[model samples]
Target: MTGERGRGRVQAVAGVVLLAWVVLFAAFVEVGNPLVLLATAVSGGLVCACAVAGGVVTMRLTDAETAARLRHVFVVLEGTAMAIFYLFYGFAFSVEPVGRPGDFAVVVLLVLSVPALGALTLVLWRSYAVHKIVVDAFGPLVPDSGAGVPVQRIRVLGTVLVTVGLALAVSAMTVALVTPMYRPVLLTVGLFVTLSPVVLGVSLTRVTDVYSARRRNVGNYVIVLAASGFAVSEFASGAGVAGVLFGALVFGAVVLLVIAILVVREFTGEWDRPWREPRGRKVSP
Candidate 1:
């Protein structure tokens, strides 16, 4: 289908579904425990807001490829949100339901979905904005096929690793959600699996001359530290060490803040300051 028609249909469908969800939520909000209902309502609202915002952005983009990618991303996100809500309601009201198992699931979905939307937006923007700049800035640094490894191979390897890792992570999450008792182990494995590909991809980008190796390494290290800290905090929380969990959480937050700055700087050309020097400046060896 044409991009325009596709996007219009997506927006219309999303609007109707979200509106129906809102109406149903309003009708039943008073029937359940107030706190549980409140959490579900808020999470559902956030999902709807993100879906709408993503659709709006998709509509505004002039690039057909980018718009299509955004459309698919938001569709998957909205569908996943709806599925989680359905599952939560079904189990919560079942005759032999356990004590609020779906509550944790809904909260986890919300926590994961918001940042996922943001990351999709950021990555899409980065791909479009930096494509030509990266080629011009680093094309000269690339060596001939006889002298060095091919950039295409590096990119392919990175893509393969990322796809495989994400598949594993998603599988882990699926199993974890269905079996709550194994959630801690499954989630921990998924976290590391998801991140390992990211680390490997960043490293591979260095060989492709897309970004400075030093800066890439720095960003990768910071993110790894943050992930480690967060993982440790989860373990601490399970161990009942409140202080350890609090300290690790704070450390991860600070590390993430630093990485966020680095990401902004990388995109803003701050990391390329030396590469973009005046014509007379000596080029890297």
Candidate 2:
């Protein structure tokens, strides 16, 4: 199928099946527990939102000839994932008789779905925006060997995301070192603790866009793994004096130290060269 028609077909797959799923759910299921009802409503909303967003972004792909490969990728990932997630929720909650094991499953799904869907939404939307800019500027002849990244490569969105990740990472480390007694900033620490993965994921993905293929994930891996270790230390904060002092403070500082060493290693070597030219700093391609 042509890209335009394919876009339409993908949207149909999302909208039609989702609408039907909601119908079947309402007709057969009984929600005696308020929590189950809430889970159902929230999950339904999330599934629909993700599907619509993925569809909107994928539809833009048809505007750029070079975007065909991207269209295929998004179609398969979004359509199949949303469909499967919805079905999983459906069968898991249908409750043959209702309310036996929902407490744990509901908690797990709710916690996981936010990041899962949010990450998926961000990727699709950003890809479309990038594709749209290139199609507008250079008539879709952009020579991209992988994904349709434009030559000009002006990446404001990516820079902002990575900057936020750095800010959160620094703030979390600072708050821990200053002691948790600074409860006012505890929320910020919690944010870093929870959203670090998403931040790191987006940041690293953006980092790769500029780096040489072989070295793309090297420095990013150190940053992400250190951040994750630091975040996981939060759970031990309740273990008393030793916990508060050693859990986040000592461990976090140690991880940051390791990160510093790795980053220094990344920058000093020629292995990490061919980095993206910063704005106005022309590099021979």
The prediction achieving the highest TM-score against the true structure is: 2
- Model 2 C-alpha lDDT per residue in residues 1-285, reported as the tens digit of each score: 255446545664665455455545544555445444444545554555565555565555544554544644553444344333433343233322345532334443453345435534543454344444444545433223222342123133334434554655565555545555534444444454434433433433443323232233344543433343323333333335533543343333333323332332323232222334346633322
Pairs that collide in candidate 1 are: none
TM-score of each: 0.32, 0.36
In model 2, the Cα lDDT at residue 110 comes to 51
Q: What is the C-alpha RMSD of each candidate to the true structure, in Å?
A: 13.6, 11.9
The candidate 1 region of ten consecutive residues with least summed lDDT is 89-98
TM-score of 2: 0.36
CA deviation > 4 Å runs, candidate 1: 1-6, 9-13, 26-37, 58-198, 209-285
**Model 1 C-alpha lDDT per residue in residues 1-285, reported as the tens digit of each score:** 246445644754574466456546445533324443443445445545554555555555555454434543543443344333332332222212125532234443343334333433433343333333343445432322212344455555556555654554465455444544435653564466355655555454444333332334444443444344434333333333333333333333333333333432333344344454235633322
lDDT of each: 0.42, 0.42
Off by over 4 Å in 2: 1-7, 23-28, 31-36, 49-102, 105-163, 166-209, 218-285
State the number of backbone clashes in model 2. Answer: 0
